[model samples]
Target: MPRPLRSENLQGTLDLLVLKTLAARGALHGYAISTHIQQVSDDFLRVEEGSLYPALHRIEGLGWISSEWSTSSTNRRVKLYSLTAAGRRQLEIEQKRWDELTLAVKKVLECYG
Candidate 1:
């Protein structure tokens, strides 16, 4: 059996992922954010706690996202993260960057291979 490619180096795209996820799914807790990314990517993208929480905090610090304390289904206090207007704008920027990056990679692949 072949091994699945490890996407651990996806740190560069973490901000875009979080922003897009919150934009699409509305507000979600930290763990929910992690799981959502993994599930959406068919388990190919795994956001570890060591990586995710920091990104969440950094994004909140940038004022791209707002956090609120909310009770979860399990009756535990959780911080819900939601996208802000700035985040939406950032999402657009990130999307553009991603598109350009993919296009560039495709060109390199076509030229070299």
Candidate 2:
């Protein structure tokens, strides 16, 4: 059975997803980032602007990402976000941790089941 999606769970995974998305898709604006996440997750994940912007700021502060103002196709100014080298390195470490954590959880669940 698929696990239920919970807010707390989503919050924890959002950063990882964001980093992976930028790594794969290159630079993207906030809305594009949210849309990509939603689309890729088949609507399972929705990155609200309130949550998304703050997360972006936090990651940028962490040197995992950087942003610059750019004009969108519609000629509106938007901040385009891209992963930094540090961010790429962080993503690798986080990916390992995520894999280990999920494997442990799966083992625990299977053991109890």
Candidate 3:
């Protein structure tokens, strides 16, 4: 059986995942973002609420994302997050960095094996 993923490793990739999620969906509330990540990962990834809010706030402060209190489709009030123009640009840069990191790690693992 495969070992479960650690939160420490997930922490390093949370921002990228969040950016991808917002980019793909356009806009999403905090709860939806967490739920989507968990669902899409088939429950392999567990996004803790504690870590998620801080990351959201950090990205918003960086101007990579914007948020507003809006009503969801179910009519409940929530802070819906969306990527700004700057955010999209940043996402492109980050995605490239992530791809590079992934490739480098893969190469290292291949060499070790």
Scored by CA lDDT, what does every candidate get? 0.90, 0.89, 0.87
Give candidate 1 regions above 4 Å deviation: 1-8
- Each prediction's total of clashing residue pairs, residues at least 3 apart in sequence or on different chains, is 0, 0, 0
lDDT of 1: 0.90
List clashing residue pairs in candidate 2: none
What is candidate 3's lDDT per residue for 30-98, written digit by digit as tens? Answer: 888988888898777778778889999999999999999998778989999999999899889889999
Q: Tell me, what's the RMSD of every candidate?
A: 1.7, 2.1, 1.7
| TM-score against native, each model | 0.93, 0.92, 0.89
The model with the greatest lDDT is 1
Query: Mind giving the per-residue lDDT tens digits that candidate 2 earns over 76-103?
Result: 9999999999999999998998999999
Candidate scoring better on lDDT of 1 and 2? 1
Native-to-model Cα distance after best TM-score fit, residue 53 in candidate 1, in Å:
0.4
In the predicted model 1, the residue pairs found to clash are: none
Clashes in predicted model 1: 0
Q: Please, what's the RMSD in Å of model 1?
A: 1.7
